[model samples]
Target chain A: MSKPVIAIDMGGTKIKIGIVQGNTVLSSDSIDADSGSGLRKRLPFIQKAVEDLLDREGISLAEITGLGMASPGIIDSIQKKILSIDKKFGDAPGIHLEEWCLQTFNLPFSIENDARSALWGEWKYGKAKNFDSAVIMTLGTGIGSAAIMDRQLLRGKHFTAGILGGHSVINYKGIHCNCGNKGCVETEASTWNLTSIARSDKNFAESPLAHAPAIDYELIFNLAQEGDAAALHIREQSVQVWSACAINLIHAYDPEILVLTGGIMASSSQIVPYIRKHIETHAWTPWGKISIEEGEFPDTAALLGIAHLVGN
Target chain B: MSKPVIAIDMGGTKIKIGIVQGNTVLSSDSIDADSGSGLRKRLPFIQKAVEDLLDREGISLAEITGLGMASPGIIDSIQKKILSIDKKFGDAPGIHLEEWCLQTFNLPFSIENDARSALWGEWKYGKAKNFDSAVIMTLGTGIGSAAIMDRQLLRGKHFTAGILGGHSVINYKGIHCNCGNKGCVETEASTWNLTSIARSDKNFAESPLAHAPAIDYELIFNLAQEGDAAALHIREQSVQVWSACAINLIHAYDPEILVLTGGIMASSSQIVPYIRKHIETHAWTPWGKISIEEGEFPDTAALLGIAHLVGN
Candidate 1:
């Protein structure tokens, strides 16, 4: 059997740590992040969670091949370090993650951006296996994307190439993005901006969405199904924004297949067909049509991707 | 001295054939293209033009290392054939260009999309020579773009990856493009659509632009310089479209430098500063700022690029 590897996925609100063997998670644990204090303050808790997982699984540190970490922001995978943390973990770039791994477990370590890690996971062990070129767009709080071309991950000059699809301007003059760009796809149709977009509709007050306790895609989609006019408008607009984003990504990275993942994929039945039909009708792919599909692993994808990266 | 290579650049209105040594054009000839006749029908004329150039320069076919051709379409460089021709030379894909080279000149041949060829030329010999990662945006009748990542031309699953930056949707709800996508940067701000965009302005009827001999950037820029209200509005809108396109390209392909080419760079004095300011303020490049510059070669870029490809 292949040796087990320690995998960590650092997300905005939670951190998941696990002992992974091939595609199986032998043991795992999750902890809420200290959002106020940032990633640096939460390091000890993460380490303890990993230790507890191993102890519960009766696994020795010596049995682990290596440690793999997936984090939000730009990651210099070649150097095994986080290059930037954006706003999620402000102190992450200052942390010597590889050195910490060497000191703690005496194991080799690898790190990558969470989005790219998910892509690697999908490409190596999930829906995108056997495809030489593929792109994965995670439509959640923001649209996170990653691309693999010619069987190699596209890490651009600054390690920001495939991860910025959300920030790609879909409506160039429409709205302002927190990233400082105007009309980014994220600004137009992400969970972070969904409420504002819903509220902006003049008919929002007349729809069931305005009466909902909390506004989200689930509520909007539910209301739209119930024949709410404003809900339907917002749903259609969101689909168009997402479809435009899909087509933009298709044009940007000429991939053979596009895997749609993220919190929003719970409605993949509606989202997948919309984007597929848009690409089929609009994309100028003379070679052939691109395959659009749902992602295989959702919650554990980055963890699995970390396992693949470390194993490789 | 190295043996010369024959380079051919097939444009919409003209065909240029040249014998090249390194960065220098040893000898060259240009002939007007019969736009009504397809590329297959014009094969004899192209061959005769090449033969005339070789004879006039007193060079034998045996002295040439190989033949390299650049055409305005989706070129399958590996197979040395055009994949799609858009409207120009609509029957180009039916021609077996490599077979024709073998039958006529008995030489190895390679073909590339004109945009990619220009990028290679710039990367190998022009402003982007030392940069392993760069993007070139050609702003002409339409916005054409190509990218070089890690020193390799980024040809995606299909041969369309780095060459479709122009078609990337910038305004998801704005206008329908001929390519079938809505609100592409090309549709928003290219020469082909400039008149319609200008006419859509309410003040256009009262502006000096309403009486121009032809509606092109040259006329609009001139009027904008003279403080024409409608011309100035169009100029600002075009710049925004172009700047948005620049940001989208930067986000899509993380390059160290962006080289702006094509006919519109004639107004680089204004275009360069606007895009530079936009990128400096908006692009999330943690490594550093990306340098924006005008293309070194305008008219002869693809010809020079073909020379580099065949020589290498």
Candidate 2:
């Protein structure tokens, strides 16, 4: 049998590291992250985390195939390098993860954007497995997406293809996104912009949500369920933004299926069906209707994907 | 390379027929079109056009490699079938162009979306020849686009992949489009919607443009050059829409070069520089800048592209 692999899914707030074989994550560990600091400073911490996880799992470095990383940046997997990052991982573009792995673990390495990695995870073992072409949307603090066209992950020149749905402008006259574009899907509806969108609403001053300890989709969904007017408005508006995003992705990728995942989907019970109806009504797919489904694996998907990447 | 090829570029208003070898069009002809009437009625006319062209060029049927068509619809080129179309070409989906060619001229044939065919034409023989990856935008009565990612044409599962840019919603809350979307790039700024967009402007009733014979980009560009406020406003808005569209295409396809074409680019002197400036200021591309160039051929690109398709 082939050896197990080490997978690292690095997000803005947390870094999830795990040992994975086949489709299952054997054991995992997490580290709170602060990307504002350059990536070089965190190398030793990551090394220790991996070492400790292996020790706790009673596995050795020699017993694993390699290490793979799912990071928040543009990546060139073949060259095993991070191409760029957004105000984070300051030293990443200049650092070669493969060289780091060779020097430290003396093993092979691979890396991809976290969303694209999760797409592989979904396609090989979850909601996207049955569809030959699929679009994966991860609604979280930010909107992250990846697309599979004809069963092949689209890694365009510069490796930005099929991964920039969140950054696509769904509203030309709406708001300015930090990415320099106006009214990107993420700018209009993602969790990172949720509070601003709520505050800018005319109903905000009278809404109960204005005084909440912390604002998030879970709280928003709960308040909206209780018939809070501001919460309801926010929910309605957010879903529309996401639905519009769905239509945009459908037009751009022409996928057979769209897989929805990420933390914001905790409200999937409210979000999924609404998006389904919206697409049926508003999208221009004359060939046929596309199916929308919620994803099964949330926490472990990128890790599983990384394991698969290392195997290849 | 071995022999010449027959090419047909069928547009909403014109059908251009030509004989091409390598990078040059040996001879060409055109016929006015009214696509509101179905495509089947014009088959004989097209057949005669090809026959007369070949006769005048002193070329026999056996002198060409094959025949290819650039049509305005979704197509399965390998299957040599038109899969779907707009309101026009009601009978296209039911007919096989390859079979028609075989029966009429004993030749093999292939068909592709006109925008996609033009992209191939540009890639092989025109503006996009220098880049391995590119996005071609035809700005005219509509905003049609096709992307080449990593030197391969991206024909998605339904063959709708990069061809639906005109339908992508750039403004979810703007006006409703005929394709069942809201504020599509075409709805916001294409030639078909130009009059309506102008008619809705607050300046319409008082402006001299209110008395124009018919409203179009050429008049708008000319008036704007003469400092007509409404025309200046329309020109600015149209260019911005096209620029946002360029960003959307860039984010969607991740191409290194973007080639602009079509009749609307008659105002390229005004549109190209504005879009180029907008992208530099607002696009999120961090690796490097994308080059934008005007296409070399206006009337012959899709035909050239079809020629290359049949040659292959």
**Top of the candidates by DockQ:** 1
RMSD for all candidates, in order, please: 2.0, 1.9
DockQ of each: 0.83, 0.78
Q: In candidate 2, what are the lDDT values of residues B199-220, reduced to their tens digit?
A: 9888888777899989888998
| lDDT, candidate 2, A129-217, per-residue tens | 97889998889877888999888898888888888888888888779886778889989988777888888878888887789777888
| Candidate 1, A230-292: lDDT as tens digits | 888888988988888888888889999998998888878878888889889999899998989
Per-structure clash totals for the candidates:
0, 0
C-alpha lDDT of all candidate models, in order: 0.87, 0.87
Model 1 regions lying over 4 Å from their true place? A34-36, A103-106, A211-213, B34-36
Docking model 2 quality class: medium
